[model samples]
Target chain A: MISKINLAFSQCKKENRPALLTYTVAGDNTKKKSLEILNAIAPYVDILEIGIPHNTPVADGGQIQTSAYRAIKNGIKVKDIFKIVKQFKKNNLNKPVILMGYYNTIFQLGERSFLKHCKRSDVDGLIVVDLPWPENKNFANKCKKQSINFIQLLSPTTSDIRMKNIIKDSHDMVYYISMLSTTGGRLKVSAKEILKNYNKIKKINPKQNVVIGFGITEKTISSLTKADGLVVGSALCKTISGALSRGTNPVRTAENMVKKLRSKII
Target chain B: MLKLKKGVLLIDQHDKNYMYGGKFGGNFIPETLKKPIEDLTNLFGRLRYDKNFIKERDYYFKNYVGAPTPFIKLENLTKHLGGAQVYAKVVSKANGGAHKIYNAVVHALICKRAGKKYIVGDTGAGYAGKMLSMAAKKFGLKCKIFMGAKDIKRQKPNCDAMRKNGAEIVPVYSGSQTLVDAVSECMRYWVSNCDTTHMAVGSTVGPNIFIKICAWSTAQISRELIVQLKEEFGGVPKKLKLINCVGGGSSAAGFWNEFIDYNKSQVELIGVEAGGPKNSKLHAAPLTFGSKIGILHGAAQYVIQDKDGQIGETSSISAGLDYPGISPLHCFLKDTKRARYTSASDEEALQAYKLVSKLEDLSPSLEPSHAFAEAIKIAPKLSKDTIICVNSCGDAKKDRAIITKRLGFFR
Candidate 1:
């Protein structure tokens, strides 16, 4: 059976447009506000990637890091993240929810137990930022045991040989880092250059659903529509932070921002 | 050189294969970092076995680093302690005034060989930054040193030396504003410039390749010590105690590398960690306190974290040893019962610093003072025939401000 995540991507592929993936820190501001925000933006979002806020996120840029900090300060726990995903799934079953985070959190919670929580909470997929391929083989197999998609990652720095190995080992989806940067960095390379790299990765395993992430904003989203999917994390997070500071409701602000991002790709 | 048990865990193993113990280390890194790290792993694997590399490295060790630093029996310290005969490897006399220079010089050599023109490093107490700056200048490579903003305020002397060596200082103002933040920021910066810059990781932490590189680099300390040991005892001593302070565990890893294979009856290793200030719950003693296994940077090892797995901020009187995580190799040793680890409080470390200064006329940084304190405690238990050698890995001048603030005017 095709996973819900694969079905979402297939639907987008059939529609001749890139799937719109949005990332937000779970329990940002407050649990109620975070759930409301997820529901508010669920219409435009194809797959929801919720960050399990980490205090020391080496890969996150400043914008997403701020979102995570707020969530952590508001007393977000691993169980709280599952609650948010569960609440969102209760209302919207078709949209896939993927937890993107560092590996320490899951290791702290027993890996098997955490997957049990994922299954119970209806979490469709997982993207452990630090658990790359080969090292992830055991965990990925464990993830597969529960019928969850364990997202693999590729980068511009990844060699052709290693890319093929990674693609072969990957589940249904692969997260292609469009450039050599953390979450919120500006476009150091052109959008055209990003797609060229994206196309090269696509050629390796054309059947695999590859998504482009990092440096993806409204302006760059349309240019990257050639890919299967695009991930907008920092941009939406920046909106949440920017809105809260300006005394605006973050849920409404994020809904509008994600909707605008969705308008571009479709 | 003492032959190591190659391929037992990561000892003598430098191929793309990584780890200290079988389960303690692996390259769990982003895809962007994978290629550069693998390239580094391959480069080190080939270069470590090449005799030419060793010759060129030692050429600098002799001329540039002023190595073969004095290993002397501390008669005054021995008399003051009144039990075991105490000895010390005087690393403060080495260039850049610390054992950190050993890894710094080797990393500079690596950066040059990789065809990279620039090198970047993260520093806590400024010793790593200063040492790498000095080596980068000698190798004619551009250098950038990431330091915590708070460290810049306290460790002025070493920071000044880093600047004088023509390296750019990137002040990190992130969480905890210390070594941990500096390292994270340094890694973030490397993600952008990895094509041209080789990150000279300051300690035996981070990814598996870095742990291996740092272990290989700092192994020079033991390389020289073994020859000195033969000269001191006319052969290697069986009843010897090897002690050093373990922050990120580079110096201790080097000091104990050749001795790991030795039976506990022959060479017993003790590692000292920062116990923080008295009456304060904070500390840098992950291995001493039984921290759980978690991934920090790239390697899965023992780390101090909250109930939610967030890396906790650690406090130490000495900036050098102020870290919440320990080397994977140290964690392995601790679990295997091959080595013992203990903590020295800030008060005890300060007292040890003053005692060593007064008795031996040698001042040590608070980082090594922790080791000295541990040695002082264990010496009374051991007999006079036993030998206890401490790796006095750094100087005290950079710690003058903290020393003066805590202890008042010293006679």
Candidate 2:
């Protein structure tokens, strides 16, 4: 059977527009609005990456950390993120959903059990930022058995030999972290740096679908449209947070940001 | 050509990662207040060894707090035990006797330097709170102390000292209505109104900055011992070990810093916990039984957290000794096998209290009474000449009535 991920990427390549990836922290500020945000953004975006908040997220910057703290203080448990996903499915938002977070949260929730829960929730993929490629093989195999895609992140730091190994071991598309710093750090590094890393990774595995993420915004999406998919985070999450602070509709704010984001890809 | 001071690790003042521990001790407060916490920690770390801090501390140590708090040589107890020649470093002679003064004085001074007019503190010992209030009064800072209503009834005189120092006693009645509750209340107030307000924590529980201060002040015991024994008894003991009961772990950390690199083969260290025939899971024995590597109050340590990720159960004979967890540095020490930890029950500890009062004319904090209980059991196993040291961390004046009420008068 042609896998769903391959099918999605095949459709992405043919469509010529970069896949619109929208990211939101589940239960940030408020839980009810978080669920609303999921359903609201699903139709506008090609994919949704839901953040599972943790107490100590090692590799996040201030904005996302603040969001994570709010989510945690709201009594949002790791299991509750799955509940929100289930609620989104009940609303018939068929957009592919991925759970993205640090490795500790997944390690704390045993790999086998977490994959099973993801499968039960119809969570299409997993993107643990800190888990490197070959070390994730056991978890990747579990996801494969469950037909869940385990995504790997590649950055400017990836060497040619490492890139080859990572692309070979990865079950899904390689998520290319666009910069060296954390998710919301000022993007002082050029898109050329990421495109340079992208070309190197493509040289190793040309057929592997690669998605660009971290600090993806409308202003920078044009430089990264060559990638099979574009994953938006930080900037989009920050936009929704800004709107929520001003008492604007979070769903509408997310939808508007996605529209602006998708326009850049086209 | 110069013989360098050994065992000292030096770092440049400007190194980015120059904190005592990695991110654990780095000042990560908001930028607006970063300078203050950094200044406070740096100033305190410097003052710990500063001649003035020592000179002023010595005065309190002598006449006011009763310094040279005797190192009573437990000759009969040691001979009976046949283990080590145990000596107690008594700190109970101070106006409000306890090693809590060591840190409390520094905390109050930090408040004074920051141009804060009032000092607020939360305490499990009530001694640290009382000491902070007393220090604040002496230093001309108005102070308020938050204590658990349950603790207030248990430790009445310490509560009175808060009022005597013109400190407003805010009784916390939150979950468990104990020291932990009082701390939570105090923290909530501090975070909301971070003005010219300084909050003094009772023990070396929150941050390593507090540990450095407590260790500095209480290290005087080790310094005095080395001098006294060298001058009066010919030379240092062949092997010297320091034992202090671990509550929030200040006394133990203070005592241990002096002998951090003392040849373990020669000298040994022991930390006693409050123990009874209870499930280790439910007991307040962080070193003996805790399995968590989570943050409590502030720093990461072994805490008795329940399955639902809540701070779990704690138990002790004395209100001062009652805490769910201990200092993270002590946790690190315990894990590295640098120090050994054990516990003694109420029955054994009470007996030790009586034995010490009669034999040595010393009344120790109930917390160390637990340590004495353990000493009684193990003393018979050591050589007659092996020296063991114990820190009587505080005064036992408030404990007599509790003893009378519970077990009748000291037989």
Candidate 3:
């Protein structure tokens, strides 16, 4: 079966525009609010990434970390994430949904059981931030066996040799971290610098879809849309958190933000 | 001169291969830390086996840190036990008052060579921090130690000692307010300051490269024990049992590294964990009781956690042993059945602490008191010909206040 992720990338290629990928922590603020927000923005985004709130997201900056803390405070559990993914898939089958988080959550849930839940819930892909390539080959193979796309991550510090080794495995897409800093930090590298590294990776495996993430916001999305996709995580999460703190309806706010971001991609 | 292996130096390969099996070890750092950890891993892999580095380390060990510490027979305790012939490797005789100075000096040397002016680390009982601070002072490097807020209260003297040695202490107030939380805080701090700082990991925990470096540096303890045993027993003991307390498992790794490759049937390696209280919902014995495998401090290991996979709280009278996780090396050893892991309750440890003091006129830190408690339990059942050697890795002077309070003498 062709994965939903591959189909989304193909759709973006046909449209001649970079895929607009947006992320939010599942069960953030409240379960009802989080699901409503995701459902509201599902149509505008080419792909949707839902973070499985973990207590220790060491790779994330202050923004995503706080979002996760709030989600957990509202009593979000792994079962709740699976339920949200199932509901999202049912509501929007055209848009692919990927579960992104640390490996400890999966390890805690048992690898086979977690993958089984992912498959049953129609989770299209997985982006484990901490489980890097080759070190997580076993888990990736399990995901592949279950027909779930295990997205690979390539950072600026990844060596050319290591990149070749990493891309040898099949993946639906590769996430290229734009800078060495965490998710919410300011981008120190210019678009030209990111494009240079992105071109190097494209040279190694031109067929693999590449998405630029980390420090991407609405203001910076126009410059980064030259890649196959752009991931706006911390920026979107910060928006939802900021709106909720002010007693505003975050669902409508996030929907408008996604529409604005998607409009800029053209 | 140590002969260099004649070939292209294999670089950046062991991060995946350094664990017990190729399946265990690898760098799982955040993207922000990839470059620095890679560089440190490469430098450590090269320097740990380099003959010149070894010579420099040995010179520092002999002249500066006073290594090759005496392995005493413990004749009085052995006779009192009336079963196994007992021995203790007196690591307390080393400078900085414990065996931690060995790894501290080696890591400080690495930092100096790499042109890093500052070293950062997390400590449980403050012994490792004090030792590192002393080494940093000697090597002209600034030091910062992140300690748990709870541990600071228990180990006040050692905290004072670390500060006296010119180290800045950062109190951690995260999960459990203990060593596990301190480790998490330290990792976060290192991620931001990795450019000008080197992490002096206090134990054989964290990432694979750090574990390998600590174990290699500390293997000097087992090496000296081997030579001492050879002279005392006319050869290595026929039936040798090695024991040490396990926190993040530095002492056990150091004590058992040399003998792991020996005949499995003839050697027995034991790791003792802190069993805080019997029925009070407090204990740090993850290996003995924990059934879950989780990631903490960048390494995959057995962790004391709840059903939801949240890391649970841990406690021990000895701050060093009060951790929620064990080193991946210990987990591997336990899984492979190469070592036995047991626990001693706070009551048992307290009794053992007083017994060792009364029997041998030597006061042992509560960390090693766990091992001594286990040794006292098993030694009586063994035959007289069998020999058991325990690594007395710390002194008891730092635990005076806590011990006195626990004994009801402070009121």
Candidate 4:
């Protein structure tokens, strides 16, 4: 029973490249434009991560915040997000789709109901920014029951003891927050420093799929290609924001940006 | 927990595993914060019983914070109400003119002990920021205070005072630009620089470690009150009601810390939240309104959020009481039926401020005026032997502009 998420990582590992992951708000510009953007970027991206727009995304930086705010203003509902995922899964190639958000949205939907939606929409993974280890154990178990990969996170500040606990409970993949900052923060710590820490986590369990996220822009993505996977969120979100301001379709711009990111990581 | 020479208990003996207890107050922060949070938890746990730390804390509480703040009987208000005897534990006598400095002092000292030179904090009405700035200046640590842009304008004097105390003020302009956003931004900033910085959370509404730290530090108020009660009434009186305003529940936590173990028949605790404007639909009374359980900032508690779980916009004339969430301790207390929760509307709080000023010749900050309003409402219904003690948690000087604009007298 190999999950699409695991398959993506395995395929990338076989190809000697890190899996390319892209994150965008579910209804960033509009309902239709979001679907178009997802479709346009699907070819280059190994894993497509959709953000559930929350009013207060404290963990997210300005670019992702703006995308979330736009989707929220458009009155995008949770069911609407599931619909988008279902449509994207139906119309596109079989790439893994991971829904990333804070825990409250899932709490609002109830763990069972939210997992049901995820299962129906063919969502392969979930990355709840707020639900870290220990507290997330119950929800992670619930996510497992639905066969969805509940991605656990590890940060540089995470001690080896806690890192072991998180990795043990992690599903198919684990997300390594590159630094101790919100998404889209400056690269305060150099790539060498981040990878040094990443390599330690890797040494703890080499077989586990670990992806590096946060501050993964074009300039930095190439430097991070040694990791199992790379997540580019704010950069692609900034592309969408730029396209909207210039009165252009974000689909092509997002596609091109993902292609560029894929080029670097692969 | 040590009982210090100044007749104060450092921490509650029964508060075992206060960080994540009984379905509330877990550390729900990002993994980047796990190290600092755990480090703080361990340090605070060790310092609670340390004799040297207790002595140093009491030294500041007595001389710097002006502790054992006058427990003055409100004779006029008691006679006017014609039922219960009223008293106020004047926490405004504390340094920074609010109970906030209690937490600020402990956090600054903790930062100093942790060997960090930078301390960050968040403020809604600027009390925590002002207090943190003063404490940081005293401790020779660089201070950064995150405040909402909306608060920066209304709480200008406090902001100016923070600047005077040499603290850098970071204005958070996102998501209603109020206390909640300030806290969010402060936590966001801490995620990056936590290795060398200590985040002095303004209230007991954040992560598990912060909630416990705030509750433990602010418990100094109750340590003072326990002795004051015996001094005032010769002993603990029958039908004692302890009231304090509940925003993030710091003042109330401090006010009722010792009384938590008291029998329900002996002591009644009341927490008054902001009920917003009288005719409007918005309010900050989450616990009173039976807000659905949801996670906000870093803990799971009763929060005002939509069915979709988006944190709702909250409003109150007092910026301090305008947060959408409350302390997890209060949440636990409310569930256990150990305390009563209520709300005071903006109009009622303003009216209480006017009445108390005319009668007591002492004005309270809008935050505590809500508690006073609750006391005023229930005083007439009780017996003459019933004693009502309200923690006048802050001075009214901070609300001069809003008071002048609303009721036309604070100028």
Candidate 5:
């Protein structure tokens, strides 16, 4: 069976532009508001990257960290994330939904139980930021057996040998961390350097669906149109944070921001 | 070969090819930190066994930090307890008033040799911070420490000691406002400033490479103990019991490292954890009660977390013992039954604190007071001929203010 993640990538290929992947904390501020925000922004983006709002997100920068803190303070639990995904899938949305966060959250719920929850909730993929290659092979295989995509992350620091090993078992897509920094840090490296590394991975597995994330704001999205998808996480979360601080409607604000970012891709 | 069981990677304990047997240690850091951690690991491996590095460390240990701290028998306390013969490894006699100076001195030397301009660390009780500050000053390097706001308030003397030694203290206000938060903040700081700063992790609780490096540096405790036992008892005891209180478990790891290869049935290793106050949500004994294996501070270990996997808030009168996680090495030992894990209540530790101060005329820090409390309980239960060595790793003079406040002396 073709997973919704693969289908989404294939649809993006037909549109002749990089897919727009937007990430938001699964219960940021409030569970109700988080669901509303996800529904509002889903149509404007190709894939919905829902964060599980863990207490420690080591790979994320300040913006995502603050968002996760807010979400956790608002009493977001793991079951609530499954509930939100089930609600989103009940709406018959075609956009693939990926649950992204650290490994401890899923490890707390046994891997098998977590995968069963994902299958029940219709979660298309998982992006456990801390579960790097080789160490993650067994869990990745379990994810594959359940027909859920276990996305692999590639950074500039990933050596050639490690890259070959990681790509060998990587399924659905590969997440290329754009720079040697966290998710929201400044994009200091030029576009040429990013493409240089991106093309290197492509040479290794040209057919693998590769997406670029980190430091991709609306303005920077236009510069990174050469990949299969562009993940805008901290930018969108920062927008929600700013809207909440100003007492504005975060759902409307994030929807407008995603629409504008999507407009920049083409 | 590694096996994944219940989301935990299990490795063979006898695997000498891997450091610490990948079962206990794994690098779960961010991508940006991989290279820096690797660099630190490689530098540690090179410097750890080098002749010049050994000479320099020995010179500093003897002249600067005062190595081979006295291992004296607490004759009065043992007589009063009326049971097993008790001894104390007095690490407080070492420089900076604790055994943590050994690691600080070694890590600072490593950073200085690596050409790093700044050293960063996180501390719970502030002893590590003060020691690192002294090491940084001796090595002529800039130093910064992340301390929890609560710990900064509780450990004011050590905080002042760090500042007096020319180290900047960054108060962390995240995640229960404690040691775990301080560690998280310090790691974020290292991630951003890794080019110029080396993270001198305060304990053997972080990534795999860090644990190995710290274990190497701290092996001095056991190494000295081996010689001291030989001089006093003519040889290592056949029925020996080593006890130490564990927070991040560096002292316990150091004290037990050499003895792990010994016959397990002959030597008994006991690790005491903070049991907090009875009938209160203030305990930090993860190994004693916590069953789930989870990742915290980069390494997979037994973590005291809530049902939803949220890191639990830990509490102890002793700031050093108030942590949500213990070192992964402690977890492995506890899992294999190589060591017995137990807890001492806050009230029990306080009683032991006073008893040791009065009987032995030695004011022990609350961190080691937990170990004393356990010793008081178990020493009486053991045979009179049995030998139990309690690692009195900290001096209670540093906790005078907090102790006075808790005892209501001001009022």
Candidate 6:
């Protein structure tokens, strides 16, 4: 199993480089529009965490939910998302793509089918919010066979024993949820607290790369430096929603947000 | 030529009610959970015919809620209004006062057997939660039910039932503050806490196990009708027509099992969804009108969802018929055109409910009123000798005041 923090360290060959991960729900607003947003974001980010829309996204806050709902309404499915990843690969967008969502969609699609899709779609990893360690052992084996990374999340509520188990079971970078509540709830939790948690996890699994997510806005990206990567979801989704509502160019708007996040993370 | 063991479980091919749906009915849950859901589903199937499960279920039905509910044959109003002879299937006979317990008992048992101590569910009517709680208590399990804060007042009787069963009701004040929000909240809770707790889904939208369990429970109506018709008439009717109301499409699936294979026995299955035209557009008439195949709860099926994949409105008079999606089996049934689908307005269902109560002294839950109203339309078209079966899914002793008040017989 790959430690998330170590994975981040291995990927960071460039000097003074901070990995800026851009998050977007596949086929948000419209498939074409979402594609445009992805293309616009391609130049700025290191990895793309594409959100697969499920009816119930428990871990997500309002903004990601809205984006996911839009994507689902636009007739997006797992196959469609895989197509997006394939297109990304065809374009030589070698930046690793991670598909993130609830496990129901994954389970419904079947574990073997999902891992196959990840492989065929050029998806590098998975971050199923509900698939905690030990429970994911069976799926992790399938992912291993498919050469797809099975990512796990370590929450603040997770005990040291559970953390060690999660770290051991994970095959990709550890996605440390920066907050206790759903995504986009609020930004009350500071970067120091996130970093403190990240450092403790890193000590146990020194080989893993740590990425902080949930409520990591553009303004707060700079404060989250202790981690190898910063994942911004709700803010990106909010920008996409605002752009669509205002009839503004979503690509430019997304690009602008990505630029701002990059500056902050750097 | 076929080697069949004496006790070997074999799906009845000759039974017109069999729903293979071409390999879709098989269980797809984890191998560990496969046996429980399968056993529960099989028990549900056998319960309709098995003397014991039925005896236990009927004991609760007759003594706790009251049973052998009268089938109220519609009066002159249906004829005067150019409608069919509607008959109400009084389901208010089930304890906890709704049609939810028909399958909730099996879910509770499966959970308890799996060493699950706590049971959590989302509810608007609180019927599922209450019935689940009652079942959990009987099986010695702890239960917690999630309800939308706004619905706690409207569905007070259901809440009382839950509390009576020693269940803790968690009020959710999330988005929409209704069944959808409650579902979302409950799903979140389950994902975070599926270790010792088995999330008892309210309807047939989760896994194939749920569909099988519900289908088994509902298949009882058909089995009972087989015996009842043989005794009532000289023989069973050649053509079987079954109707029931659908919310998350559980009860309808249960009753519709007898009519699944249209090619063989020529059984007609009709499911009536709630048509709340006077209400908001968020009503649960997805199969009959608005819907697309999307994942909800845990399965891929038709759902009324907004742009953000959040749950939407499902309008119906019966509290039991107020959910956004139908089961996947219903989807396949619709796709294959094996079953006919329709909807009854709230006014039509209410009128049917009143007619049943006044004429036969039988009170039915609002859910079955949809089927009752549809039966009114369908009965006239059939031969006078034709026998039509409507699942009296629930009885409405609690809704006596509402039914009477709606009829303008009381102040």
Model with the higher TM-score, candidate 3 or 4 = 4
lDDT of each: 0.88, 0.69, 0.84, 0.89, 0.86, 0.68
Taking all chains together, the TM-score of candidate 3 against the true structure is 0.87
DockQ of each: 0.75, 0.04, 0.32, 0.73, 0.44, 0.15
Model 1: lDDT of residue A2: 86
TM-score ranking of the models: 1, 4, 5, 3, 6, 2
Cα lDDT of candidate 2 equals 0.69
Summarize candidate 2's per-residue lDDT along A174-224 as a digit string, tens digits.
788776556675665787877887888878878888888777777878888
Among all windows of ten consecutive residues in candidate 2 chain B, which has the lowest summed lDDT? B9-18
What residue pairs are clashing in model 3?
Answer: none
Better model by lDDT, 5 or 6? 5
TM-score of each: 0.97, 0.63, 0.87, 0.96, 0.93, 0.65
Q: Give per-residue CA lDDT, model 4, range A1-266, as digits (tens).
A: 99999999898889999999999999998888999999998988899899999887668888898899899888888899999999999876478999999988998899899999999999999999888788788889999988999999999889889998988888899999999789988777899999998998888889899999999999999998999999999989999999999998889989888888777766
Tens-digit lDDT string for candidate 1 (B98-168): 98898998999888889999999999999999999999999898999999999999899999999999999
Error of 2 at B388 (Å): 1.9
lDDT of 1: 0.88
Q: Return the clash pairs for model 4, or none.
A: none
On TM-score, who's better, 2 or 6? 6
Error of 5 at B283 (Å): 0.8
Worst 10 residues of 6 chain A by lDDT: A1-10
Model number with the top DockQ: 1
Among all windows of 10 consecutive residues in model 3 chain A, the one with the lowest summed lDDT is A53-62
Evaluated at residue A209, the lDDT of candidate 4 is: 92
**Interface RMSD value for candidate 3, one decimal?**
2.4
